[model samples]
Target chain A: MTAVSIDSAPKTAARRRERLASGRTYISAALIFIWCLIPFYWMIVTAFRDVGYTFDSTPFFTHVTWDNFNTVFSESLGNHFGRNLLNSLFVAGVTTVVALLFGVFAAYALSRLEFRFKFLVLGFVLGASMFPGVALVTPLFQLFTNIGWYGTYQALIIPNISFVLPLTVYTLTSFFREMPWELEESARIDGCTQGQAFRKVIMPLAAPAVFTTAILAFIASWNEFLIASQLSNDQTKTVTVAIAYFAGAQAHQEPYTAVMAAGTVVTIPLVILVLIFQRKIVAGLTAGAVK
Target chain B: MSTLAQPKRAPETPSPKTKKVQKEVGQDRAATSQGRWAFWLISPALVLLAVVIVYPVVNAIIMAFQKDQGLDPVTKVFVQGGPAGFDNFVHWLAQQCGSAACAPGTLGAQFWSAVGTTFFFTVVTVVLETVLGFWMAVIMARTFRGRSALRAAVLVPWAIPTAVTAKLWFFIFAFDGIANKLFGTAILWTGSEWPARWAIIISDVWKTTPFMALLILAGLQIIPAEVYEAAKVDGASAWQRFTQITLPLVKPALMVAVLFRVLDALRMYDLPAIMTQGSNGTTTLSILVVDQIRQGFNSAAALSTITFLIIFLVAFIFVRFLGANAVASATPKTTKGQEK
Candidate 1:
């Protein structure tokens, strides 16, 4: 009885320690969740609150209303929030499509075909990715002004493609490299040309990777602000620039509540995309970093 | 019968040799075609990059040397200035104007302070992010209920646009806002220097720590569970196991995350720009560059070139000494068809 008691005592102690540890884990997890989500929560709460309650000291939700959201879409004070949303969509969409088209071919060649200066190509891509956007601002601003392309969708889309291509190429290249070469070889052996094999066999298999790349590229181009802020004018402004310069109904007052509403409107779609594709996004992100 | 068989075998051997030559020739043709296809495939991206990145970079450098188009100090008429060798560089680097030190509040005088502020933000935020991210990564790596939910929640901030992030926090940090209400302190977060810096740091840390965590979590997931089991069986404490096993193993991912965050923080503009408008001593190098661009284009060019060099230098140091393997990490490990 004593021996059994002694053995069981330690096991119970260990189990108790584990339970305590798990409890601690739960507490920390909750803390992390709060830390991550509080600002977003604050934004949502303020978005729905009446503009009169903008300075209300209450921490939790109160004075819920749809007025601020209305303000976001309303044409009052020359605010073009609705139009800016469409502009952002158009720019991000076209940038994604074009970048994906160019990136797929480049990534394929970089990963599959043996060639000299492959690393040089990769180096250029990486270097361009790391190049400071601010450095390009003055030159691009001048160049766009010279060519009369300033504040156009093309102006936004062209630079966005350059910035996003690196990410697309890197993610797709890593993915394409890991794909099973035997499938392509078998297709070739079955009287398929190389292009035909890539099109029929490899592309269908590559759809998921391509989708991941597209989502990432779209998100990136959507979030771009530095160049867009300078290059975009009133008509061509993106959601980000629009929010930055959002006008209040009054001349002097800052539109805090209205801006929060705009912020929520802009963030919700991205947050939804992220939540839905959380696993794929994580996979795509780490593919470049942790490979 | 033996002689006839010998002649037949010789004919067959030569035919085999001829087939070998044909196969080699076919392989050469295939290789050339692949190369041609690759060149065509990659040129479009290359051309776009050249036009966008390469040309702008070269132009920025050239503009750094040429003076901004403005009125000559002596002549009242606005005239396009000529080459001003080393003048733009001196304006920022030496903080000198003509023969005297630039006055305070001038953009030239802000160069060193911007550099200092940029480095400060980079170091402080990265350190905070690494520690917090490591902790979060450890938690996320564990098997638990609602893990997926936690991961999705963590991504909320990261998914938010930086401009929006700036606005979201701007509301929070406002006077009589939730932050003040919760803390019961009415400190002006954006109206002062240190508080403004902390506000930027806090917002940055909140936004990017998840990124660091995700990267570190990937590294942690790659660790074998048996390693921890073995350590436990050998009576290693949790702390010891973490320091001895997990820390060393996670270093590669951790370093990469830190390097990226550092480089990112160095060029930080949006957060501070929107939050404080780069006032109250929150002027980062990029902010300073933009500010200078408004008043003096040539000097801003020089400032940006300097900024680029600084970032390049840091990246070089990281790759050279710290073994960050930035390039290798981006490259694929396996080539064609030796898949295990």
Candidate 2:
């Protein structure tokens, strides 16, 4: 009993020392968490507060109301803001669907099949992904204007698809490569044709990846600002562009409340997506960047 | 169903006549068809890519050499003039270097400043992001209660639109905003030079640090725990273990992540444009290109060509010096002969 107690006393002392070391780690983690979350919290706080209370010296949430949100929907400018939100949704949605459609086949081929100059092709796609959107802006502006596609949704959507397609291919290819080869082989042996095996067996397995890719593609297209700013007029302006040009009820006052409310509106969908599919999003994000 | 089932039985009970034919051509046919199928499957993407990306890029190259006559009034298409033979390029260089063709205090001068700003932004933000991201990644990689929640919180900023982030930051740095209250100084962030630049940097760091951390975390995850344990057994300190083991192992992923960020940073447009409208000496290469597009098309094309070349060169260097497959680590090399 004396020996065991002696051993226990030393063990307890060591644990205490270890805990002291770990204490810093926890504190830093908490600080990181707070740093990450404060901006978002600020946005939400600003969204609920009245326009009059936006510039108070005190930085606490007080007299919170849905009035700013109401203002975003009620006023004439709010209608425009509302339309911009719709435009953003449509543009982002179409970009996601179209890119994924093109990406799946290419990703599948790159990941699974052997062909001539395969690395070269993959290299080319990778290069294109890094193609500066700004570099393309002038040429696209000229082309779109010439084709009478300027100030149109298709104008914005087309450019977005081209830029984001490479990302989709890279991310999805990595995902497709991770799928077991035998799944397809067994499906083939079990009286399934190559096409049938892919569609029925492989695709179901790839659904989660596809969904992750979709969310990423969607978020990217949603976040597009430079091209959307150039391509769209009032009717087709995206939420990002709209937010940039957002005005108050009066010209002199900056519509901080309405803008915050609108900002919150735009942010909510993305937050929801991240919360629901955080795991998949992380996987999708790290897929190409890390092994 | 019967047709499919019939094929399965036929293959099993292959006739003698067919067996000879199968042996002669079946393997060759399957190989050729597989290649053909692969080509066919990938062609749609290749075609779409060529039409959209390749065509425009080629067009821009050509346009850079042509005279910058504004768009036609009737057709709205850019009207091309006689080949100027490096006139635009020379003019652009003059703006940056103060040549005869282009003078100081002009658009070209502005372009030079933007380039400098871009260089500054890229270096500063990339450094901050890498360091902070590494710290955040270390935190994220730790297994604990609510680790998943922490990761989600970190990604919230990444998911938010850049423009929204810009606006959010703009408000947060306003005269009466939280930044002033927190710092106890009412500096005009957006209306000034260094403060404005800092605002952009702060927002960018907040927005993209998650991406850096996520990429680094992936690298960290691949590092087996046994290496650390082995080092511990050898009486290595935490600092020593980290420097020797973690840093070396994490280099490739870090290289890739930094390369990606550097490229993206060089093309920065949205944050500065939305936050400060490229005012107060915060103009970047992209905003400059867009600005020049308003003044003259050919000049804008020239500037864009320069931007593309810089990006291309950086990519080329990365690929040439770094192992070409560094970024391709995402996919296993499953093909027959393409293995590194």
Candidate 3:
């Protein structure tokens, strides 16, 4: 009886400790969730709040209205929210398409083909990825001005492609290298040419990887602001630049509510997309970071 | 009959061997052709890179040496100035105009302070993110219910645009915002000096800690569960297991994450640009470069070149001295005998 009591006492203690550790984990998890999300919650709450109640002290929802979102869309208020969204879509779309188009072929070669200077090419891509946008701003500004290409979609798309291409190539190369080449070999044995084998067997298998790369590249291009801010004219300004320069109804007011609405408008779609593709996005991100 | 069968079998064996050689020769030829295809495949990206990245970098360096096309103070007229040897560099590095030190509020005068501010933000933000992210990663890495939900929640901040992040935090730091209410003191968050810097740090930490956590979580997942079980069997405490096993194993991912965060914090512009407009001593090197560009293009070029050199130097140090293994991790491990 004494032995049983002693053993049971320690076991209960261990169980209690386990329960306490789990409780702590949940508490910290809750804290982290709030810490990450409070800013977003504030943004959304303010976005829906009436313009006059921008400073409403209540932490919870109050004076909810759509007026702020309306103000964001109202052009007479000097807010180009709609036009800016369209511009963002156009630039990011074209950039993604072009980067993927070039990136897929380059990645395939880097992964599947036996080539000289392969690592050199990979190194170049990595280096370009790390090149500072500020460094390129002045020269690209001047060059675009000289070529009469400033404020053009091509101006934004071209530079964005250069930036996003490295990410696309790197991610896709790793994905391709992991693919089974035996299928391609069998296709070749069955009388398919190299290109045919790539198209029929390899590309179909590569679709998921391509999709992941596209999402990342698109998001990156969409969020680009540095060179965009310098190179874009009023007509071609992106949503980010538009939000940065968001104006008030009158000259002196802050336009806080309307800006929040604009921020919400731009962010909600991305947030939803990320939540949906969370796994794939995480895979793409960590693919280059870990072996 | 035995002799005849032996001769026939010997010929059959050599035929199979000869076929294998022929196949190898064919593969070698296909490899060369594929190499040529690779050259063509990559040239388009290489050319675009040259035009967009390479040429511009070269142009920036050249522009850094050339004088700005502006009024000569004595002449008081616009002059497309000719080459100026180290004048642009000296203007920034020495904080001088001609010979004397630049007066306060001049673009040149802010150079060193911007450098300092950049380094300050880099160090503070990277360190905070690494610590917070590691903790977050440890929690997320544990086998718990709602783990996926936690991960998805964490990604929200990372997915939001940097510009939007700046604006979101801007509203939070407003004079009559929730931050003031929560703290119960009306400290001017974005208006004052230290508060403004801290505001940037807090928002930056919030935005990027998820990235660090995610990277570290990937590292943590790769650590075999057997390792912990074995350590447990040896009576290792949680702290001992974490430091001795988890920390060392996660170091590579941690280093890479920190390297990226440091480089990113160094070039921080959008946050400060929108939040405070680089007022009250928050101008980073990128902001300084952008501000200088508005006044003098050549000087901005010089400043940006300097910024480039600094970032490049940091990357070199991280890759060379630190055990980040950035390039090796980025590339695939299997390179030989796998391709047809």
Q: Candidate 2: where are CA atoms >4 Å away?
A: A1-10, A57-59, B1-30, B70-80, B96-103, B322-327, B335-340
lDDT (0-100) at residue A210 of candidate 1? 98
Question: Looking at model 2 chain B, which ten-residue stretch has the lowest summed lDDT?
Answer: B1-10
lDDT of 3 by residue, B188-279 (tens): 89998999999999989999999999999998999999899889878899899999999998888888788878878888988999899999
| Tens-place lDDT digits, model 1, residues B1-340 | 1111112322334477786776666567666777798999999988878887888889999999988887644455786868989899988889986678888988878999999999999999999999999999999998889899999999999989999999888888888777888889989999999999999999999999999999999989989998988888788998999999998998887787788788888889899988999999999999998888778778788899999999989988987799776566665553322221
lDDT of each: 0.85, 0.84, 0.86
Tens digits of lDDT, candidate 1, A1-291: 122455787989977988998998899899999999988988888899999999886768899999888888888668888899999999999999988998999998888886666766876787677777888887777788889999899888877877898889888887887688778877876878879999999999999999999999999999989889988888899999888878887778778899999999999999999999999899887776775
| Candidate 3 residue A102 C-alpha distance from true site, Å | 0.6
Please write out the lDDT profile of model 2 over residues A131-182, one tens digit for every residue. 8987788899998889999889899998898878989999999888777768
lDDT, residue A99, candidate 3: 92
Q: Give a tens-digit lDDT track for model 2, residues B176-241.
A: 898999889979999999999999999999999999999999999999998888888788998999
Q: Pick the candidate with the highest lDDT.
A: 3
Which ten contiguous residues of candidate 1 chain A have the minimum total lDDT? A1-10
Q: Summarize candidate 3's per-residue lDDT along A1-291 as a digit string, tens digits.
A: 122455787889977999999999999999988988888998999999988889887778899999888899998987788899999999999999999999999998888776777767887887788778899888888788889999999888888877899889888887787778788877876888879999999999999899999999999999988878999998899999998889978688789998999999999999999999999899888776766
- Interface RMSD (Å) of model 3? 5.2
